[model samples]
Target chain A: MLTLYSFGPGANSLKPLLALYEKGLEFTPRFVDPTRFEHHEDWFKKINPRGQVPALDHDGHIITESTVICEYLEDAFPEAPRLRPVDPVNIAEMRVWTKWVDEYFCWCVSTIGWERMIGPMARALSDEEFEAKVARIPVPEQRTKWRTARAGFPKDVLAEEMRKIGVSVNRLEMRLAESPWLAGDEFTLADVCNFAIANGMQNGFSDIVNREATPHLVAWIEKINDRPACKTMFAHSKSEFADRGRKVTA
Target chain B: MLTLYSFGPGANSLKPLLALYEKGLEFTPRFVDPTRFEHHEDWFKKINPRGQVPALDHDGHIITESTVICEYLEDAFPEAPRLRPVDPVNIAEMRVWTKWVDEYFCWCVSTIGWERMIGPMARALSDEEFEAKVARIPVPEQRTKWRTARAGFPKDVLAEEMRKIGVSVNRLEMRLAESPWLAGDEFTLADVCNFAIANGMQNGFSDIVNREATPHLVAWIEKINDRPACKTMFAHSKSEFADRGRKVTA
Candidate 1:
């Protein structure tokens, strides 16, 4: 049995979850809470030295990196709806789309969503707790340097990221408008990758996903949300997140 | 004949060039001068809408992105030396290494070599030429916002990037120490990727490749430099770059 270590709202974990769901593969999901720093725990570190989530422990061989894990799953289980086309041209298209998800989309979500939204939210906490949380950031020296550098970040940086999000969403809308998916007429891993990032942006940075700026992207998101598998995954994740929140509150 | 649109001294273009050289495939290299922003020109943008280089026009089928281009070449010309492994495990390893090269290594090199080193080099030009070069930055707004936001970027951001280069060199050294190639015991695309980056670093940032800091990496660079394909490609690129530089200087 494959054990998938994941968290509720992380887009990185969503990649593998979507792949598992898309492939209809049975796997055990062990939810991790980054707020609690569970991902950085010693045991989890043993599983993934990088201490990042969405790690697939397949028959004891650990595979990290969301894209690599997703590709591994696609290769290991090729029967379910082919996530990738076998033809070289189609494969090239898929790779470009996948790279876009990682390079452009992921950057927006992480910077805009995490910095503009999550970091401020976290900072609103009690000083002691906030300090503890900050202390727990992996790679403390690097994180400190980044945070310090980020402190001087322009006030409009968030707005600029939002604009890029707008452009990205517009592009996605154009792509999805032409074809049902990011790649083409078919649903593939490209859609899965896009969905994860879109969901992250929608949840964490809703202002960027408004109909005015990104009507097509909003519509595409709604369409994907209608999928039973996607719905199931979201419902499960939401419930799990709420349950975990309640535990912390208690 | 395949048409490869590329700029001199980019790791992305080197992947396809190395593969073509290894396979002895015939292709015409149309060099783009970054100094002139040729890649973003209307003609080149038709080849790659993203306005990035290393775009290959193979019988009218355009392919971009280094890894994807290499994979496409491998598939299209299987008689060529195999770049990817056949087994699932080996493929997984290859994918991870490839992603590492594209994501982490490329980021380090660009942040350190290009942004810090090359940008300053380009900026040290006549006012008209410098302004023209600066105007060509793809995401001017985003770059401005990022630079503003990182106003207090550790005075040592460049130093930090250089340190990462050291770390990268160390990792590569260890890998080469274990076997003649990056992936244990076999020379695959991984070697090509590493060689390209190392070659660029040596040519663009020699300080990072000192014998005291990374003797093994230095040795590995020499070994890769000795390869017939590598030697031929470098000689061709060197003359081309010299000619282009002289034209620009004139």
Candidate 2:
């Protein structure tokens, strides 16, 4: 049996969550709500001292980091509906985008999400409560980020983040114009990873992401959304994030 | 035949270079010297559109991104002397650190390296030459970083980067004290990816990384340096970086 410690379904949490659904694997989903700062709690930290969500516990073994967890799933269970391609060449091509998601795309998308969506939710806590929450965070850099999110990011930083989103959109469009999927013709773990964030940002970046601006990416998102596994994954999402996913596909 | 487009023996480039050396695979090394801005040249862009080095060409196939390339090497060449552990549990553990290096550790180390080593080299180019080099860079974000490095990172940014380095150091010490090698008793690609940076930073961070503060990690670095591949790879490094590597192992 497998267990996934996640923040419902969306962002980094959704990669492994959707992968499990795609592979038709059963996992006990233990939700660690970041909005409530439950991840900063001691019990959750015991599972992952970093206090991040989307950690996987495979029997007695533990794996953290969504990208690592998704790859581990592929490695441990190489069944049909394989997330990565069979050929090494295509797999190499697929990883370029996955690494892009991990290194560049995720940071730009997360910065925008935090500034707009997560920050407001985190800021709603009282000063004392928020201060205590920040202190409890295991990593110093993460603590500063939470504090910054609560305080509001600088205008220049957010503007640069928007510009990066535009760059990300351009990169994705360039890829999708040539091939049906991020990696190539077939949907793989690359799609699973990219879709999670692309779907989340669709409504917010509608001006840049609409059918008119990024036709290929728009079509790709719609097609992936219609997949049965996508539907199953969305069925588990919390209301706020679920609404965003539904709106993007609707 | 294999072809490696690399920026010589630095952090990111060293990952796959050392991996190939460890496997005793022969590859023609084509240095895309970033100091001369060869990565910005059109021909190199054909090999990798984004023009980042450490891209591997296996026969006619292209693979970019250091972490992805290392993982691909393991997948395509799953023989004896595996770069990653064979056990699923250990591989999962190994990936955690690899992902950490990609996500958290690398950025901090790179920031320090840029401020201390690479930035000065880029700054040495004349104003007209630097502007020309900057204009040739395909990606906007990378262009901005190159410019920032030349101008020097903001004091607060550098300070925070150092703090994160401290966080990384503490985390590594905690892991190394428990396990003989990162990821377990068997050395894995996690070491290959990480050693490139840790060894690179030893001279600059001597106070923080010495035997007193981080004994296990220091010993681990020494043990990895003792490997024939590490010595061979370091022997190929340019003088400034070579001096740093030799000092740590000495």
Candidate 3:
């Protein structure tokens, strides 16, 4: 009844993947590996014109954008465990965190991830293969990013990105200190979205994110990792980056 | 009691302001003049730590982010008219457009706007006054943007921004040709969020958004403008840029 087009359980892909698990929803998982540029292929583009992943196909309808997909699941299947809060004020808080991840947190993590991991992977491809792959990307900005990744992101851009990550991490630390979760006492989609990237911060950004520097953030990551649903989501990884996706959570 | 702290009926501010009008809700409007750096003032920052405008205080709970505020209005005031579609698929579509506007469209428009309009305003200030204004901005990125605007945005950056605007406009035109409103037959928040920025494009960036090039978008604008609520919203403008906000619809 449901099929999720995702890139395993990391970054944007992990948001919906974890949400589905937490909601006790069983659906097909169609992995669209970014490493091979499968997301930009014609078949994938047919499903989503923009060719971005973490899209949910319910029956004949299609939904893109990971945060939107999470909200869609909440809207379409109301009987599922509510990842969204019932109180209007709490819901507003949930959304602020979700939007924060989309606009601020995830991009910083992705920029660093692409620079450290994806850049090497892209650079490994043959010149002919690389050019062909870059040409196939549907979004012009994404294509530019891919080329930049392969060539190496500018040092200043990376530095600024790292600085942003520091700011975001510190904010998370401060927020978690005040409340049990990003949106207050209850676990909501805010935690789901933030953890998708925050989990990565603990591992890849150890220098900036650790018990000594960010004890609250570190504790929250552990709390999220201890969940049964999170375990299932991590174990659900089937892509080539399965190890990378499962590493911190495993 | 509902109280909205906004710049005016334009850009991000128009989203909640127009939504309230469409819902037929009466609320107190607190106009925060950005030209005078009121948003960065201590009192405004107490309302929204980010020092961003277009924040809603429902009763006493504070809500920030223009799109999130619009959704908050929908959730908090369910008895009011629904700006969101009842169907899950349609809600997803509405969110996609809203998110696109927030992520892709708004920044480009704002970049151009600041360069053309705010640059002159900033340049007019005395050297000491400009530095003092810049120092008051809480967010580092916003402070950097203000400094950039005063220095004049890079020629290539503005050119690139224009190119992106053209691409976004063309996409809107193509989408409008197929759907009656952005989310389908229903006039949803997608139209509400988009028309806020699109209406400005028609007037300020006529070179790219004329009726000849974007008939469907132009028609959609006229359709939205024809709404009595839109007329009321334009008339609700109280900032220094009131005329600029009301001009397109007038």
Q: Could you say which candidate leads in lDDT? A: 3
| Candidate 3 or 1, higher TM-score | 3
lDDT by residue for model 3 (B1-250), tens:
9999998888889999999999999899999987788998999999998899899998899999999999999999999999999999989989999999988898898898888778877898999999998888888999899889999999999999998998899889999999989989999999999998888677788888888989999999999999999998777668676564344334
lDDT of each: 0.70, 0.82, 0.89
- Name the regions of candidate 1 deviating beyond 4 angstroms: A116-160, A237-250, B115-157, B174-180, B200-206, B238-250
Candidate numbers sorted by TM-score from highest down: 3, 2, 1
lDDT of 1 by residue, B1-250 (tens): 6977877534677888887787788888788876566776777777787678788899999999888888789878878778777765566777777777886677677564345434544556666765564465565553452343234335476678777777777677777666766766666788777776777455455666667666777777788778898778877763344344333334
Q: Please give the lDDT score at residue B97 for candidate 2.
A: 83
CA-based DockQ, model 1: 0.62
**Candidate 3 at A155: error in angstroms?**
1.2
Winner on DockQ between 2 and 3 is 3
Kindly give the stretch of ten consecutive residues in candidate 3 chain A with the minimal lDDT sum.
A241-250
TM (chain A) per model = 0.83, 0.94, 0.96
What is the per-residue lDDT of model 2 for residues B1-250, given as tens digits with 9 covering 90 to 100? 7888887777888899889889888788787766567888989989888878889999888888898899888888877368998777788888878878888899998887778656777778899988988888888778889889999999999998988899889988998999988888888898888887787455668879988899988998899889998788767654344444344335
Where does the lowest 10-residue lDDT sum fall in candidate 3 chain B? Answer: B241-250
- Per-residue error for A201 in candidate 1, Å, reads 3.5
Clash counts per candidate, in order, are 2, 0, 0
- lDDT per residue (tens digit) for residues A1-250 in model 2: 8999887778888899989989989888887766567888999999998888888999868888888788889888977469989888788788777777988889988887777766776777889887888899998778888888888999999998888888889988888999988878889989988987897455778889988989888998899889998898877655345554444435
